[model samples]
Target: MRKSQIRNPKHRTENCPLSPRLNYFRIFLTFARNSIVRDMTFRANFLIDCLSTITWSLMDLGFYIFVVFRQTSQIGRDTGWGEWEFYTFLATTKLINGLVQAFFMPNCEEVSELVRSGNFDFALLKPIDTQFLVSLRKIDWPALSHIGVGGILLSISLWHITQREIDPAQLTLLTGVAYIFYILCGVAILYSLMISLAATSIWLGRNESLYDFWFYITNFSRYPMEIYSGDVGTPLRWICTFIIPVLIVVNVPARILAQPLAAETPEARFLLFFTPAAAVACLAISRWVFYRALRSYRSASS
Candidate 1:
């Protein structure tokens, strides 16, 4: 019996390394480095997407500027922002959106699909934690155009506001803080949302709606959420806030700039609390759902 037990592989250690969380971060960083190289190999794609990025940014600025001119006098009453103010708001939002699209969302799609194809079994069999590999598989560097367009627009907007020399350090402080928290919440919300959807792939046999869902969610963040102001309707605001939750991810930093240079507003301070908390809960719930859904998966055809 002892010899048989020694020969048997059934009791061997499972292949997984550290828990999912740590492994996810590790693979994510390595994947980032590789993606930069991959994207460079396709220079034409990068140039084309870069032009699109700048064009889209210009269009966004044009839309807001047109609105500003239409209501030049009654501006702040609506967005609490004037022409320059609105430009500033959009510049930041654009930058954040660019980063999210370029880096985060693409990878989320890869993971969720892996689960749906019954390919998840191969991932589970790897010697590394599955979640880590799943999250960091694909990256798009062309999205970096949003960052450049954002900088140019922001500088132009700031120049309009100051009408004098502006300091880079001051600009950096706000953009830096906003970008950090914005990406964190973005990653959190996207992963949670994708996981939730992907979990259903096990039962539904396809998450075809995922692309649509991602497009809708990102659209909110593309514009300044403050425009959704006023009574915020009630039902509309409820949908925007609870269902999509893009406001916290995209608008908070712009909120910082929307107020006066030295704002004392309580709502503007550390305002991402709700979004991050929700992301955590959503991701957790999705993880649990994954295991439950996996049990029901019958491989391929629904």
Candidate 2:
């Protein structure tokens, strides 16, 4: 037998507790490095992928500038989501979505194929958590290019806001800190949602529509939630804000940095507190659902 096929017994001991957190971090780095090398080998494919992502993002921005921004100065009722402010919100959404797609989307989308081909059995034999191994095994470097575009958009918005004196007082040190923290929370919430959907593949056997379902659900999150606050959209706002919680992911961080609510208002206080709380709750629920799905998994050999 080739050495590559050999499994070192010392790699995993049955009596050992959970894998060391540091070991998981190292393993993740190894996976990312290998994926980068693989993508580099296909230089043409890599370039095409990168160009495609940048083109789509630019087109989306252009649509807003030429179409929507030309028609209205604000999205909400005098809430100040002007051209630059709304662009900042769009940039935040892109940054969050970019990270998720780069790190988790490829792996999550591959889950059904893994199960169907029995490749998941190898993942289960690994020392680390199966979900972690499966989710982080691949990184899409091209997808991450959106982060650069997002950063540029964000910088332009910040400069424009300062130059125009659009509530410059709201951009305080505290607000900056809160914005960063909530951006992280938003990312966490999105990751939780993606992984949970991926976990469903274990039971469904083949969930090829994962991307379609995910896009449909998260499409609502791309715009300002205030647009959904009218009589026709109030129920949607409630469901997304309280039940699903995806709307708050980008809204909180965007609002904090763009058009902040009055600190003295009850609604503002609720949103300020609810953003972090929702992150924690969503993560806990998703983790439970993932593990439960794993427990119910049955290998093809069985």
Candidate 3:
């Protein structure tokens, strides 16, 4: 090889075809590093954003503690969730939502703006998958504070459960592994929903209502799905659970850690096995939606 080729090895590697999965992972890491650097450049703003996220999370927790907890010990009547168990569930929600908000929300939210401005054309021209590039391009590091707070709350809740000997299954290695896996499943499901909603920007030209729609939909997932029982609520539960699958996003993993596995009803047991499959299906549907929307996109020049 010539001296010039040796000196510019990066050019060669860039041109060479590599494992698509590994290449995408590297691109994601690059995006993450760039986001961190960008955030750090505005240190004061970054700190304020982190503090704001933490405050909102604390306020949510306080509402449950003071008002909601005053009415009932568990989330719903006959739901088996005690005070600490409910806290465990809340913590799980925080962890899963935090991951989604940190890694995917910003990018997904920007899709509309990109589409409106016709900048999405540039993204489509990229060598990597447009969906992957657009979805993982931004990282909201401040939103990750929720995960830290969640970890702390989860530890405290688990410690109390162990001290009280409330849950017979307890937090074992298997449970821990299962908890983490399901958390990822929860994150995947939410990401799929958000990205699918965001992809509508391509057809709509501008989708300012995306956030509002997302908020209304995800509000259903925030609470325990079991609360959606009875004649009036049962139909809504079925729609959200089977049609949308948001109900299981947090409930499945949260139940694993918060409730005894042996005590789960047959229906709950079915959901436990169904959630991973739901996550996969959601992702596939989202991917299809994104590409289909892209097919309808019209360039600015055209």
Candidate 4:
């Protein structure tokens, strides 16, 4: 047997170049850089991915132009979310979705595979937070094409709104801030939902339905909540608004920018106030679920 040497606890800490948190931040930057470089190396695939996303966005716009504009003047009878107004809402939805897809989707989509392959054990052993590591380890730069499309759509909608409205002064700094704030809120809600679903892979062994589940839940947010208002849509409205809170994610931000909720129903007011709270609650619950799942996880060797 080799002679055992006594190790000084201070040695490692003193020799470290950065604090634990700072080092983790540096690692995250490295991961982002590496992902960008990797995507650049596959130039053809990256360009194709970008083109596909832009094409899909155009198709979605065409559907609204043909179907919605042809049939109805506005989505809701009472609320003033007309063509350009609804377009603003759609644009906001696109921006939020694009950011989530670019940053979180690829990583969350791989969580089940990592767990099934026993690679998650390596994540757990890292010095940083496992959730952060799993969520941001990969970035899909091409998926961010929607953000540009959304900005263009938003600018057009805003121009229409200014031209149509009697007083274009409604687009104040406060309104702009609120829109940006709630866009970030929407992203947090989506991340929470995705992480919660990814965590389920711990017990289920494989969660092949991650994307399916995500799409189903977020699909509810892509449209105006007003469409789901009548008796036929009441149950769905309540469930998506109160229970899941997905409807509030897009609606709150959209309303802030496209149409102010000054004269809206009492229920709408309640949801507007509750959105920020809902974001915090969802994030906390998802973090708890993720850690709980990790605690119960066993390596493949076991």
Candidate 5:
């Protein structure tokens, strides 16, 4: 009994303590929940924003459907999408897009502003990790709704993906893992991209066009890269895949579920294999850029 107690206590003590990463996550969750409560205090604005988001999602779909219908009437074929496959692709992309904009971009923008204003000093003074704090400092309540909306749309899209070149079981597991990786890599690439931009704010003072430029570059990912045409399209597609890579996050993942060109084709399989690699590579470059930018950080007010 005594030996058992000693061994059990040792095991319990080891198991009871949280890992350093888990502790950090716990801290983040606590901070996020606190932020949410604070934001909730202004309930009117939160609900209004949430309602606006829902309206935006619905309207976006309505507009797409209307355009596709008109085009089909004139040129025939449903939006070049083939079947339900295209509809859910758009739906999932929309949801993911909203979540990224509402949550990730806002925080990054806020960081740039704070850095520009020299308020980043206050942030650095906080006890927690500066990156963690900056990343989760704010929560847009409306963006949470996008999570639910995207999930529902994705669920609906699953049926269509099934009817396509692949069946449910295979596509679901592959796409599921891919989606998780996409979000992580997407966020990493985004952070890498935005950190460099924020670093620029330290010098450029006003890059009003930066965000717009980023968006313009990313817009291509919403549709098939094939639409870009050849030769020149090849390089442009490379840029979208390896340089910016936002296109792969949405377009490639969606395509995976929507259908395969013919996995049997060498071109299709190569592109499929390359998609995640390209995203990871872009993120890695962004990280290096961010580190370089930090070295050049002039601090606010020079």
Candidate 6:
């Protein structure tokens, strides 16, 4: 048997009897367990990281409350995103961002380093799909603090909205199902963008600007897309909406929970339907880009 084949015995037909879907799921659970063990090994550091994340989330919420809400009742001029409603949107942002960071950020950030050190060769030789392995091999457990914080914030926000009778949308089982679905869609869109950027490391040789670029692009998603109206902002709205689709990441999901569809304009209604399609397209494009970049890779030995 060849060296590469021997190193990846899982690829051998006799070594793998389970169905592919089940096999991949088992592999993912193993990766997640290993990650948890690694995090627990550094318990102090993990605790500090979690505390810091929670602190930052609180500070951000406070900023919006003291600064932004002091002046206007709604996020934009008549956008219908009042204080608690906007908080719901903010909470959704945290949930989506938290999930992406916890599951994929660490792995994607390591891609360039792996390429620089020639360790990515082993990843390429793995029996499973390279994208799946590389994207999920390491989970940042501390970042899950954001999800916890977001959940608390969401519950609080929804409670306030209900008490004040401010929610434009009725809360129902179907509404919740749609909200969770779009939240996953938002995560998928962001992951695709991150992995696509990471893939460029193979061609760029070093992609040190990955995080900076990612921050800049995603910063737009932190706010309601309705705020990007008028001449100057309209162009940015168009670019981020149709071209990059970051505008829809948090917006559509938040709108599903915070605002009524009947109150939305025709354009807004159209975008709500378009978001799922955009997520699918982004995943396809990112997959193509990753494989294309992989073909350009040259091992250190070469």
Clashes of 1: 1
After TM-score superposition, the amount by which residue 104's alpha carbon in candidate 3 deviates from its true location, in angstroms, is 0.8
Per-residue CA lDDT of model 2 for 1-302, tens digit only, reads 21222233334544656456666788889999999999999999999999999999999999999999899887777766878889989999998899889999999999888887778878877656666787889999999989988999998987787668536624779888988899889888888888899889999988889999999989989998878867879999999989988899898888877776543368867988998999999989988888778766777865
Off by over 4 Å in 6: 1-15, 166-169, 261-264
Please provide the root mean square deviation of candidate 5 (C-alpha atoms, Å). Answer: 8.4
Clashes of each: 1, 0, 0, 0, 0, 0
**C-alpha-based local distance difference test score of model 2:** 0.84
lDDT of each: 0.63, 0.84, 0.85, 0.86, 0.62, 0.89
> What tens digits encode model 1's per-residue C-alpha lDDT throughout 80-136?
566666677777776766766776567656655765666766655554534445555
Checking candidate 3 for backbone clashes, the offending pairs are none
For TM-score, candidate 1 versus 6, the one ahead is 6
lDDT of 6 by residue, 16-99 (tens): 779777888999999999999999999999999999999999999999999989998887777878888899999999999999
Regions of candidate 3 where Cα sits further than 4 Å from its true position: 1-17, 165-169
- Candidate order (TM-score): 6, 3, 4, 2, 5, 1
Q: Which stretches of candidate 1 lie over 4 Å from their true place?
A: 1-26, 66-78, 111-117, 159-179, 222-232, 260-263, 266-272, 289-295, 298-302
lDDT of 4: 0.86
Clashes of 2: 0
TM for every model, in the order presented, reads 0.73, 0.91, 0.92, 0.91, 0.79, 0.94
Model 3: lDDT to the true structure: 0.85
Identify the runs in model 4 with alpha carbons over 4 angstroms from their true place: 1-17, 165-169, 261-266
Checking candidate 1 for backbone clashes, the offending pairs are 24-132
Q: What is the C-alpha RMSD of each candidate to the true structure, in Å?
A: 6.1, 4.6, 5.7, 4.7, 8.4, 2.9
1-302: candidate 3 lDDT, tens digit per residue: 33334223344457658866677788889999999999999999999999998899899899989998898887766777778888898999899889999999999999999998888878875666678888999999999999998999999988888778444446778888888999999899999999999999889998988889988998898888878888979999999988999899888888888886632779888987889999999999998898778777877745
Error in Å for residue 109 of model 4: 0.5
